[model samples]
Target: MRNVERFIGDKLQERKDNLSIRSLSTNIPPVDFCSNDYLGFARSGELKHMINSTLASMQNHLNGAGGSRLLSGNTRFTEETEAFIADFHQAESGLIFNSGYDANVGLLSSVPQRGDTIITDELIHASIIDGCRLSHATRFKFYHNNINDLESKLKLAKGNIFVVVESVYSMDGNIAPLLALSDLCERYKANLIVDEAHATGIFGANGRGLINQLNLTKQVFARIVTFGKALGVHGAIVLGSQNLRQYLINFARSFIYTTAAPIHNIVAVNCSYQYLSKIDHQLIHQKITLFRKALKENHIKTLSSESAIQGILFSSNEATKQAAANLQSKGFDVRAILSPTVALGKERLRICVHTYNTDEEIISLVNYLKELN
Candidate 1:
């Protein structure tokens, strides 16, 4: 037969040819700059205990859920997690998926019909884009956080429509004009889907997410919130009406075919919610305030973001990488988001403020950046 190895080799070559090849490697010992663990919950002892307690209650089934949720994997934990999540976000129901990526793919791919028009913000996550690609809808992208452009495109659409956006744009570390967009979607009879991947446990009153704090949960159609980033665990939930959730359970291939998320992972997420509800939110908000202060004090121009995500935009990728490298040389950990991940000319070093990040660390990192200039 024709060599099977050659086919695999050819595909690998395409990645190199297109300059899209990605390789994984371990990091050298350094301070933190490039992780999504905003609440520092990822390494928290409390969260560990929560997980331990959960493990104590259940079997240590670290193995695959063994089958899709509809088959044999669905359990009371899944149901309870979804129920709590829906109540937390003030939704009628919630559908659990294995990851934020899975949740997005399942929602966008299965929910939108062939005749539907999807108008998404250009700055939305790749998961949303992939989901839209799988969808049978006609899609359009408006400018990043530009509600006026969204309105224009929304006005032109004449069909079943959905407006997809992120509460906070990941790379740029900026908030969307949610109020304006929600108003436009209402005027145009379009459904709204907000992705809150970066806003959990770090924003909102009880960390229900930005949209939830704004009380816009009822105005939106669906929200995809992940536990990995802020909740310090894995999996995500799609919050919406009972009918919408039922529809996803029935039709979403990602949810239907993939193994359900492990039990401990679900429990960890629940623990995070409990912690957020019980903790001092002011302690976290103070970190955000101090981080913002350090950014301004250092005179490194940052976007006016109220959330934990902050950005230091350098002129070029080399400049961005160099800044991150310089930070690493010291004791700080900050990351540079490069081109294509963000559009050209907007590459940034994304700095996530968290509960564990001290005021001193924030000031020190900013001061270091100033010294570099």
Candidate 2:
């Protein structure tokens, strides 16, 4: 065999050995407790109407952005949406990115200088890890959500330190100890960056996210909010000071090299946010109430999260997959986050609750898991 083919074969074997071999597949056609569409805005009538109305106006931008944003892609709509996001999040400026992944990679890699230190929670999302690898700064990882551990490292941390964390941890379905972390950052004179991906459009008043709900924007350095999850579209925006925005535009490669996202991603995001802002309170409330009640009734133990994501721990990978398969056969969609996604023995079935999920649907699905898996 060729050397390249042999190398590829060895890599595939490694993934299999670690049980980390992922493959693309289609929907199993059950109640979706797996997607990131928190508000059900992905299929919302109002958002759809907004897009249609915009299209009907025949005021379309070009299909592709055709180049990097700094090159030829920057437009009135891009600037307009950036302003809207910044003002909405109460930040001084906003820089749109291709996706949450790119945003994280770009910001994490670029922001910290050569002598700076980035001490992040051990369980920060993968993009942050990749960004840290690409960055020039020294990196440290404290235990997840352990402020004391962070403080211990803080004692030794040198040169402009930037502490990074997520407001809502994706795999664990739990929040970071943000207030404590914020105060600690302030005390140490360190910058804080909070990824508000999971909390956006759920936690804060008007769904700005956990940081905004706790009013930590002024204290934190940056907030990264994505449109795909709660906002129910594609792309993301990093909210920060005008200085930070200008700096990223000058240095962030992810922003400079990649062709900008299509105008549709921006358009859909704007439409979705507009719908969410004016949405009735009862939309999420009734569903959340039903979901919580069902969990309580079934006694299906889960992590403590009032947000859209939920976790049901199952110790073994086989057990987790069997449970997911059983629920899948029963016409419910669920997936398991195996070891390495979380710590070993902390594997869980990551359940996502949605605003459009009906009371009956939640009840039936929970009961199905109880009876079968």
Candidate 3:
């Protein structure tokens, strides 16, 4: 008992020794190259005004949800938003969870029963990995985005199989081959689950996400969409069949036990989506294209990605951290993805482009990297 605190201190020291210790920073830099606010809606005064106006119309609006959805937390507004999201995403139903982490943890930990088999991309987000670890079913990882590797694993999988992937990977900013993966799922009789966190406000007709963007909504089994990224809000939703919604409501521990999001937060999410449905996707694509071109002109080697998430891999953690510091010194807020979070030799600086970013800023960012090297 006397030495219990030593273990915690030792782990902290390990992180420091490896240049992987993390700290939070509240300061937002002038140049915006490092936020998940791909649509710039997170800073939108329009969304704020809409949320306030919507809140004012509510009768006796409360500041807090007071209870979980299974208790006194559920409201008419919640049901309406869920239905709205389902219709927007072309899914049969939608269920809101506290966040992307909760949605993934809740679904993965509960949906796959004992004797089931779960297969996922090796580069899937950490939240999904944690969820898989918590599940009673067996889990396996395939090489990242390699269809051939996925099939090889699927061929040997037993019981009810679930295959998971991200429509837009958060680190590399590369998109999944949903059409190809969905086809594989069908060939193997595996359920395909997609995390559309980064694609929700930037892809598809009306930004419904990559699944609907590719006309593969019927091919995928489930999708997890989060508002905290492109939507510029908080919370997340699981888009699937009505049966899946019902099942999560009954069995998903994360959704069942947590206090529901406050009314104003829900109102904000709904307002953001209302704005998302009307925003110009073409204009956003123009920004993405512009940034990509800048990187190419500089001859800066980067991961092949058409999305807003872009990464420049460095050989070591120290090199990546120093590079990120150099960028931040010039007012770019790019972040370093150090080892353990990524593999040892795969350290990188993750740069996120937004619609609000000007051409000058994009050019400056790529040029800075070029000049630094």
Candidate 4:
């Protein structure tokens, strides 16, 4: 066999040995607990109707974006949506990207020039880490949520400094100390870039995100807001100054090269925001409270998180996988996170709670998890 084929075979065998060989699963679980659709917008018939009506009014009903935004993909409605997002998020301007990953890759890889330094939380999302790696900037990581360590690194950093962090961590589901981090950035004259992937549509008054909720929009340099999670659609936006938007247009390659998302997708995202504006977010908070209360009552020990993502650590990959399989057998979709995705000792059952999850479902899941523990 060819060397390339043999190398690929070896990697596949390694994954199988580790019990981490992943495959696509299209079957919807009986109990909803593992998806990122925290607000149920992805599953909403009302949102579908809104998208249909908006699309029907369009003069051009083309299925595709036609070309990249730099060429022919840019539309009046898309630009208007960007402006609306900027105004809603209290930013000076907004630029859309194909996905949250693209936004991070584009912004981080382009913004910080050579000789500039990037300081990030050790536990930031993989996209952020990839973006940082793509940049010409020198990068350093501090302990997760450790302000002192960040400051110490900041003192040692040279040239222009950009600090990147996720408002709510994707894996562990813990929130960063944004207020303090923003304060530190201000004191040290560093720009703060926050990826609100998990926080958007779950926090803030109108689901604007954690930055908006904390009133730190003015303090942050750039915010990457994704529609895939709580907003329940596709694509992401970088919110910042108009100059920053213009600069990214000139330099951010990911946004420049990719085919623009379809018109229907942008419409769906806009509709999700409109839907968010009218709904009562208190219902989501109540659900989170109830779920947390159940976990406590069942005496299930998991990572402390006020957000929708919660994780319970198990001793090994085998134990965590068995726990997840047991839950799956009982009609739950709870998934296990194993190394090298997480540290060896951090193998856990990552459970995501959503507004659509019923009270009975939450109780049953917690009781089963308690028994497993």
Candidate 4 error regions (>4 Å) = none
Ranking by TM-score: 4, 3, 2, 1
Which lDDT tens digits does candidate 4 get at residues 195-282?
A: 9999988889888889999999999999999999998899999999999999999999999998998899889988888999877788
Instruction: List, residue by residue over 328-360, the lDDT tens digit for candidate 1.
Output: 878677767777677767778888777777677
Model 3 agreement with the true structure over 50-99: per-residue lDDT tens digits:
99999999989999999999999999999999999999998999999989
Candidate 1: where is the Cα deviation over 4 Å?
1-22, 28-30, 59-63
Better of 2 and 3 by lDDT: 3
Quantify all predictions' global Cα lDDT against the true fold: 0.82, 0.86, 0.92, 0.92
Candidate 1 or 2, higher TM-score? 2
Which pairs of residues have clashing backbones in candidate 4? none
Question: How does candidate 3 score on lDDT?
Answer: 0.92
> For every model shown, what is its TM-score relative to the native structure?
0.92, 0.95, 0.98, 0.98
Model 4, CA-based lDDT: 0.92
| Model 2, CA-based lDDT | 0.86
